[model samples]
Target: MKSNNTLTFSRRNFIRTSALASGGMLIGFNFFTACKDKVAPPVDISQLNFNNFNAFIKIADNGIVTIFSPNPEIGQGVKTSMPMIIAEELDVAWKDVHVAQGILDTKNYQRQVAGGSQSIRFGWDALRQTGATAKQMLVNAAAAKWGVDASSCSASEGVITNANGDKLGYGDVVKEAAAMEVPENVKLKDPKDYKIIGQDIRNVDIDKIITGKPLFGLDYTAEGMQYASVLRPPAFGQKLVDFDDTAAKAVTGVSEVVRFGDKIAVIASNTWAAMKGKKALKVNWQVDSKLENTADHDKILMDLLDGNSFDTRREDGNVKKAFAEADQVIERTYESPFLPHNCMEPMNFYADVTADKVHLVGPIQTPAGTARRVAEMLERNVDDIHLEMTRMGGGFGRRLYGDFVMEAAEVSNLIKKPVKVVFSREDDMAAGIYRPAIKYRIKASIKDGKVTGYHLKEAAINSNMYGLIPNFFPAGAIANYKVDTANYNSNITTGAWRAPYTNFLAFAEQSFFDELAEALEMDPVQLRLDLLQNVKGTTDERIQYSGERMENTIKLAAKKANWGKKQDGVYQGFSAYYSHNTHVAEVAEVVIKDGFPVVKKVVVAVDCGIVVNPLGAKNQIEGGVIDGIGHAMYSDFGFNEGAPEHTNFNSYQLIRMNQTPIVETYFVENELSPTGLGEPALPPAGGAVANAIKAATGQRLYKQPFIKYIGMEEQELIG
Candidate 1:
């Protein structure tokens, strides 16, 4: 089930070029026709002897092609896949093409932030056009040399061949092409003709990564840069009052201690010295707000759900009337606790601030925004700031916030020197932005054994679900539907963690759908298929998910997992969800061991459009499923008196190697532009696992960290 459609380029407005100083060709084009501004050349164009070239592609006289990947690499594999799209259209050999991480250049790139898993979807057209236009220019140049029409020449594997079979390498004609006019409406390759895109291209940085190269932010360093370790309030809602740096300054290798807005920064020659100095400092703090606890959060969230004040997200077909007239009603509430991202490499950033200019470098998800914020904080012009992106060990949405980046810049500005701020694992977990605790209450009204009404209420900490989420799956499927949301603001910082609201919301909704199927005495797969039929051919603009795509995904997953087939000791569960413009379905197979449900395998099917790289796409799906299962079954983070209860792995539980299940991935291949693969696969995993546990043990788990509901101690689960 793969797409064989050919992509056609219609509008080609922004096509420009400049001759490379090395007698090569530089092609620059804008994929977004709406942006009328002329493409600007790179700031270091002359220094690098490479012109704008769309700031994406560069060709050398040695036949080597370099493509620049503009987005942040958060292990989602965009760095590899993005260039593959360009090389596919550019018609170049991947082995001869080198991929480089582009610096922050807002003038040449848009939507460079990497949080939404949209790097490819947004950059697809632009990247392809860039490569295709370059290839066209090369062909035109070769045609001119042969005194033949461009149509008589065809390019493949970086070589242009004429109808007579005579050929010239791209580099041989690059100099002539550099002086030629930029072509408009260059033809893009058909999907069926793709060679580099769908092939198994290893991550470009794989060699460097395995060889211990300095590609991550934690490995970034600057000449004469000092290391910094900061100490803030021990708990949320607490503020710094006063701090004594006498003992801290006495520590070996301790250089100086600086205070900035409720936090103390200990500067030293090395990270170990800085952390030691920070530990020796004496600080006093006062509670500035309510010291909230997990219990308090639970009570407050539940109360918000019960209260009348709520923001109505969506409503249709008189839910009250449908519920009142229904023959039966089923309701369930699901609860989840806060969770930390726990990225492998702790939060770290490098900054050098001076009166005239600012240099900031690190693994930041939002590089442009962070640089702008730094400029505003220092009262400097944005142009004076030069920011570089380093590969991130992991983001999971934590790196989206620039607080750590700001810390490095602020400290460097205060000291008037270069500094690298490093956060210990404890600091990362204790003070990091967390996935907010959330509770969902779903109710369904059944009339004549068919779902007739649906109502959903969400209560969260700090924020509610995004407005468009209410219009996702199950919205158009059910006739009478309503959604309400309320939130309780807490001083404890909370924000997007991976899939954001859908990560947990899918578990709640999908689990409820399974229960509803039981009440109706209908197979879960059949129930979903029936609901999807209601939304088929739907013209509702508010419905974000395509019924056709969801159905295909669910069917593929079920078929692959042998859904509804009874096995001697195996129990199976199915869950499907749509998020980030992608439809994904998963089937979990469970087996009991020592009175505990163990997930043995998970079959995942995704409709993220044509996967750019099957290997990378499969890696994303596997990682997401494992993450979802780990968090749902073992990981738990709670706040006690405004302080995180678990600060590191020793206390915070994660699914270990032996507990991981086998993941089988399948993609519904289509010519539709790829949506998001990073987070969509995760949202359905929790629900699939939860439903499978229910089937295995006949116990309905209403809360996350299912280990808590089972009669197993934390140690036993860990073992």
Candidate 2:
């Protein structure tokens, strides 16, 4: 099942101690405690296998170092950055290190997911320890060879040196190092000694990417792989009744037509043929009357807004008392529509299923999850399923779900042939696990000039909007605070998209806070700072993020943006939020031109602790900001009669080159452990732009895709 010409790295080449005895070092570092199944037999760890280690670092006798980048790369630059941490600690040059994408081996690389912006957050300490352990082993080996004390020998730049000026390369003593036992506790390098981490290292695959090399999911192929296109139900709640393949089978290059319950697949020799065959498929679907359209779903959400069924996620002092005693109470409702991921590369997976084994290769955010799903679907053992990950063009939390991976596996399992199921832009758009639309109602109590109370009630489809993060910004800062959530069951499928709840919640909360500040005639930036300052010294158990870190990012952002400064034809808006253990604050500068909001510039300040790669970090911030702006200003997934109305870019509008704005990014100087870099910066961008639009025109957009609310003639704002 292996492709010789492919860039896929397999775990089959894992070096054992016997292989290492031939003058090479193979170090296995166990970072995670593996979950054991009671039904499965015990496994001996005496043998050096990839499954026994969380990650494997190999140094050949020729002095080539290879460190496995365990997680899938979805253009977050993890492949370049994660290995950089290891290379820094290994005392090797970055150029000497070969960063290989690790295969799915949960016994070793457990919890290998690319979402939540958590790769660096969780891998920071464990990966460093891995490298440090290897370095200590090498240092010990070099000392034993030189007949010197290990403490007297120091390692640098892949070489060991003693006080007598005797030197030996790491490769010379690697065989000896491989024979030594792994160190239990090895001291990691200080931040001051980080030569590779803070430096601006280009992405590892930059050259291949720029030169049009094949590395993405769409580029993956195996021997005799046939392209496939599936024809799913036309609507969310519909099911396929029957399919006529008479016309589809007649198409050129068409091979076979397969049906599996509600889905029908058209297999062909090539992608175009498969697409043509799919279009020719006459499939009849039975539609469900319930959950027919977006409007109907909106009504359901609105009804649940006041429904009696509610869960009190977080509550403090009496909210009723604060509101009753307040001089005035301000209430507002915000609405956000469902959104499609629209990754640069559409969904696709290649599966070659035989009686004994199921082999899959594609772009997936969670390979381990996909493997488990395939194993369950095939009723096979988990060890028999081999899943390989390719470089994804974009993830944005869309790949977190393994439905597409399962589809390919099931199709291959049934057909008994190698199949590559490719999703057209329309198919990817229509058949979606979209970001759930939400309705949020916020009420604030104002007594004199200080805010006394804050309450938020969110109504979403299938699940609550604020599940894990009930205590958001101003949660601990407000005396009387409460959060209520309700869900409206529907047929629409929903999954995590980027920052998940915070993607849209940050917009609702931060924009409402702006209105609260305006009502009190207080500066928005100053108001957030004041609120954060209140919780800075408190020992409140409700605070999830460090109050000092949050406050620092806010102050630093304002200082960088020149908060009080004014420019001609430009209005500024401020927003701050914390998510994925990262705090971000942003200020947007916009100008109204021809009745539309034109973003001129954006200033972003993040406190994600120590940034691993400055260049990649800035790129992530800029990309996330632009993406947030695009979604806030343009993106919306619409449905009519239970069918997705916008299926392609012709109907769906995305951010264009001309629409991109200048984004200035700054990272607060800190020595704390690094947080995520991909998603935190995105949430605030939406609110910042919305607030900017409000400042430009005396209009508050309560609904998302803000273009729907603005009018040219009268500027009538609508919710």
Candidate 3:
């Protein structure tokens, strides 16, 4: 990929229009790029190391610029995007710079966890301001040396140039810049001056990633590092009744086959040896004879349709009155099965444990949480456990759980040596912590060809990935709404995957809207727009959403897609969801082939505030669309007689290159502060694809894994 300077200069015009700023001096100044004082004043930047030259910046005589961002890059591409925000404002050639992943430093970097689509927006102002402040200090140093007014000097491309264009390199002025007092206030660069942020830059680490350099935890290997493999019961809470490790102990390269509590592990010289030894070790599981099958989870969820739930998240008026007055009512039940994260790289962590301290390295999403947990488990201070985050093969939010890390710590402690615990596909899938199998009861009232009311009730195993957002509970996405939920304690362990509840939300809400639109005889997009025109909140009441913004995104996406204009045999479906402080709308075009929804194209429009890295933003939207489509259309988890039904990729399907659709991502020009990008885009795609399938077959399929709703092998044979 030719990542040259041409794209950098073109982005200046992007900021020129996006920032809507004026004046050449403001444009030339690095501090003026982000323009934060519109509805709110600039956040106080004093008395913090966030923008400190030594903390975020390290200048080299060779002109290599490093901007440290304290966030993990879980395939959303913020690793490259956030740094671009600073480099663009600094007016430096992007190629001359590199972005260093900021470690577990809370004071220097705010909220380092990169789950929501927030990486770029989170760093937008702070980093730009940091760069601008550094530039101001440098210019001041030059002005003092040249005996000219500070205002007489301007900054351009890592250099402070005087009015006559007399230039001084940033490296020459850095020592002086470091000594100056931090600026109380500095004018940010007008967007017209941006040389990096808006441009489509290639990924910063793609070269290392593609060249097979060690970028992910699975690829990490250290000298004196022993390997380990875990053997947990196939069922969620099943325990070991008995085990014989005679074969495992005799296997080549195997050191010890030991049981840590009920779970067993094989420690060896290599991952293969550990895996082979684990398979060789025989174990008997004490099955829960009375355990409820997943089908029972389905029944309990369906039983909640009678309206027994929390009624926790609500903000709208009487939905009963709205539905009562409506000309027609459309009701549907949506169901999604428990899904394994199946992150391309199975769960793995490398840890070196000694009596005094432990060092951990791997693809972990929540470094702070992991650090906290690891410290507690090790009975050491938090500072004693150093967490180094690796670029994840993929994190649909599965890595958020630190089980693999804990396993590594356990193995190291048991053997008193540094050990790496790597999960094979079988180990990863069989381990619980799946997206909970859940169900939703959605009812909508339509009058005069528009949606008038919505009553949504969802039930699932509580305490799943991302238990609940502070304000927007499950029922927060629509108005004239009555939202309720109930948690049925299951033996299964669950955690966040991609968009979390978004998986079911897309299916339930979007599918209901589709049915309602059909009953009202209105276009799905038009009906959604009309409803949102008056639809106040994501959760109703205090958890309201900006209807204007939602309407704008739908409209922009429709216009870009040329809705109802093109001749597409493939059906197109649309859905929008607001979570993690961002509004994302997606349109998925799907082809129903023998009950399978083949997603062909994805059109996405997002508003997460200022666009940081256009390339990263696009990559995230694309990846999310593909990831969600996979789960919605094919992914499933089953249980047979209290045992997990699937072990690896063979049983659990995923959306791959042959199945990935052509994704067209368009970022709505906004400067809203950052929100999560990692999982937000995915949740909405579920509904979009389901809606497209509805368009294709004049049928409302409420159950998930689109494969199930259409006709499973058992169902078709029975029918």
Candidate 4:
């Protein structure tokens, strides 16, 4: 799985061939090209149609190449970037390439999920081979026509040419190529020769998106389809006791009221009517578990951190001995509350279930997994379920759950009709799969002006950070490093939100570094550089971050922001982090305005390998930084007896446009395969802003939603 050959089309057995009735060439290949356990389907050259193509590539007679992007696109630009990888190797003109979103085809695709920002990274080699293999077949066909050696014939911009200057369009010889044997090995383009990649390609759906066309799940409609609005328990620990739907049935356009498990669904001809009818229904609920509150969670997390019973994630040396011998031990505890994803389009899914087949179409991050779940719930064959993906307004890890998809499928199965389930803003917020509330206590022992010991303890709700995270950054630098984690199982649901644990962890650790620098009487940027230098040549596999890349990123951000040189009224703070296979550094500029800190600008430096599309990459970076800053400064969510305090935007405070600072981005140039860009840039922004606020107001923020401690004294806020 690491090499290009293993990803796709290294041997003839991995290729699938078919003929086009229009005399064009079609190439299909499995993503798991080197998997020995699975067998590829036999080639069928007699199938004379384009519909039989396995959602990979379709070459038309007009020399236009259609590449299917086989990954869910949640506004991360994979729908455009994934196909760009194929077209780059296909040697087709960017103008002649038509990008399309592929359906969930587990037969030919792998890792179709959209979370983790890994679509481009994982699909890079496979997609390149897919296009290269087809190009080789075309070249072979063209060489046969001229009776010349196939090696002398090369393809570029959808044309095949020989050494004698004989030119033929790919379409002109596609018919002959359809009959040719699949090529076992094909030459890929060198990164220096790339024509379509590393270019600013606009989003493929930009036109439709700007014109407000039907490109999102909410815009989907079907014949005789009913819209549904569901009502679940208002509180996390509540369960359904009884319900009365008479008022709902009397509402206009109300068709049916069906109760399933602990929820009730109101079906109607339109979304508004369904929502209105659902509001009219009366239901009773009983507490099924302890109604935990924010105060209770805070106490529990503190107790867990103070207790000795914990899982040791990573321990490098004797932390206890290092701490005992230290001259100074600086300790700080950071806390963050649960947060909602609050996707722009809310949650909605369309499902049409029948005895014969089940049709589903919606914006889902995990379409293949959702389909299997639906199939299991309906007790139908997985092959009988057909699901389609639409462009999502925004996911940020919310759509990965697919709970709304299950609701739609279940409702359709019960009503025996096509149904689309939609969640109100309140429902989306109150009944969300939230980011787990977490607290981290980081202690650094400084001896002889050098860090000798580091210990981090994490207490979380529901789940802890992934095991691999404990190995990232400073884990190899500190000689006596130790990481411990413990979790409290809560009835309230929690799951991945954007960058997950790193979103808040970065702020905690990076802020601690700034404090450590202050205690050592050293510059913060120089302190990070020195730490990275400690692990520069180490060969320890446990360390996940690249010290060289992280050091370069930190230098770039510091140089751009003029790290130590200060302006009269401006204060700056620096933070650097590595996450999701990307290295990022940020510097936040803050100024005091009427006794309040105002963020004026942020300068970001990233090393995510090669840039696929600069425009799209910049968008991701800027969006992440703004989102991180917004949440860290303004957004706050708390639970009162298992009920969310803020259920809508009115109560939930988000950073306003006027408050958003200007962001400048710079990327390191390299030939390495592209890594994720969507979430890596976010984790460092919070840390940068927190450190900046400290410089501006002499206040150290240990809790999220920095606004809570805005006017309070440092001692009062810390206490």
lDDT of 2 at 358: 87
lDDT per model, in order? 0.85, 0.83, 0.69, 0.86
Clashing pairs in 1: none
The candidate, 2 or 3, that scores higher on lDDT is 2
lDDT for model 2: 0.83
TM-score for all predictions? 0.96, 0.94, 0.87, 0.95
Superior candidate under lDDT, 3 versus 4: 4
lDDT of 2 by residue, 586-645 (tens): 999999888778898999999998989999999999999999998998888768877888
Which regions of candidate 1 fall more than 4 Å away from where they truly are? 1-13, 31-44, 47-54, 106-110, 464-468, 711-719
> Residues 291-354, candidate 1, lDDT per residue (tens digit)?
9999999889888877898889999999999999999998777888999999998999999998
Model 2: ten consecutive residues of lowest lDDT: 1-10
* Model 1 CA lDDT for position 648: 91
Instruction: Name the top lDDT candidate.
Output: 4
Ranking by lDDT: 4, 1, 2, 3
Candidate 2: stretches off by over 4 Å: 1-22, 34-51, 106-109, 289-291, 464-468, 712-719
Distance from true location, Cα of 546 in model 4, Å:
0.4
Cα displacement (Å) at residue 423, model 2: 0.3
